[model samples]
Target: MMRRGLLAEFPTGDALIAAVRALHQEGYSRFDAFTPYPLPAVQRLLGWRRSRINYIAAFFGLSFALGAYLLQWWTAARDYPVIVGSRPAYAAPAFVPITFEMCVLGTSLSVLAALFVIIGLPRLWHPVFAIPGFERATIDRFFLGVDESDPYLDRDRTTRALLDLGALRVSLLGEEAPPP
Candidate 1:
């Protein structure tokens, strides 16, 4: 099967960023860029939003902490009344340490889960990986890949635009069969 996308190699990050900006301005939204290192400019031009991992962590953390506190209170006061050191059975202050610990645990675990889900973890292969010299994405090259599904994509016109934007090479990626 053929992969329906165009992958272009740029001489530098600047060229890739320019191409992304140009594509975005041209109403092309279904595209991604790869580079040896993170480029905030490229991200900004791509209009990528901040991740919601922090919100997920916070929600889970606070929820777990509250649950921990309530569990402790119910066990000590209502479930089975217990009095130690002449303190009240439902000592809110005493539950602070465990509550905090549960909060941290929840935050970490939720963040891990969110990261996995957000990144589509366990994905060991991608069509781009089949492209020759694409491994340079991690070493010293910048790349822009425009999905054929993009509404503004005209294979011929986009190819010409990429070349005009100083792309060193442009390739039409072929799809690779998924691992069984």
Candidate 2:
């Protein structure tokens, strides 16, 4: 949907990173940065906490694996015990391969689903797309956006802070900007 925000252009990746850090330190928490390439250091500077997706994926994997194994055990050992070649009906060892496969499958699917949810996928539009010159962010420039939804956001103050952080240009996002 349409929402107001501020977009600041940085001449370089380092400048973008620094600006994000400074803005965050200034207590502006609702913001995002865009760059042409991945910047590992920038992620740490953005104040993002550790992701819990891995843990969630692990939980799903284990649950699915255990369920699969238990189902196999119930069917083989209890429900319909098939004794073949004098082998035991339970056959725990025989279930290992299928259990491992189930674990892998569950982890893969859970992680994929988690990523979609976390990243807000299937979104065909975003406020940033309305910012002029924002396309450069995917080519040669860097961009840092401060969302107007931030409780502490003051347009004048935010613009000033962005300029102070060495932003080459700072402009209010048109589509997302609030009514005057």
Best model per TM-score: 1
Q: What is each predicted model's overall lDDT from 0 to 1?
A: 0.87, 0.84
* Weakest ten-residue segment in model 2 by summed lDDT: 171-180
Q: After superposition, how far is residue 154 of candidate 1 from its true place, in Å?
A: 4.2
What CA root-mean-square deviation does each model show from the true structure? 3.5, 4.2
**TM-score for each prediction?**
0.74, 0.72
Positional deviation of residue 63's Cα in model 2 after best superposition, in angstroms: 0.6
Report the lDDT tens digits of candidate 2 across residue range 1-180.
224678889999988888877777778788777889988777777666788998989999999999999988998889999886789998889989999999999999999999998888988776677677889989999988777788888989889888988998898875554323
Task: State the displacement of the C-alpha of residue 178, model 1, in Å, after optimal TM-score superposition.
Answer: 4.0
Q: lDDT score of model 2? A: 0.84
Query: Which residue segments of model 2 deviate by more than 4 Å?
Result: 1-3, 24-29, 36-41, 83-87, 132-140, 149-168, 174-180
Candidate 1 lDDT over 1-180, as tens digits, reads 124689999979888888888878888898788889999998887678988789999999999999999999899988998999999888889999999999999999999989988888977777887788999999989989888788888889999999998998889875666557
Backbone clashes in model 2, listed as residue pairs = 3-176, 4-176, 4-177
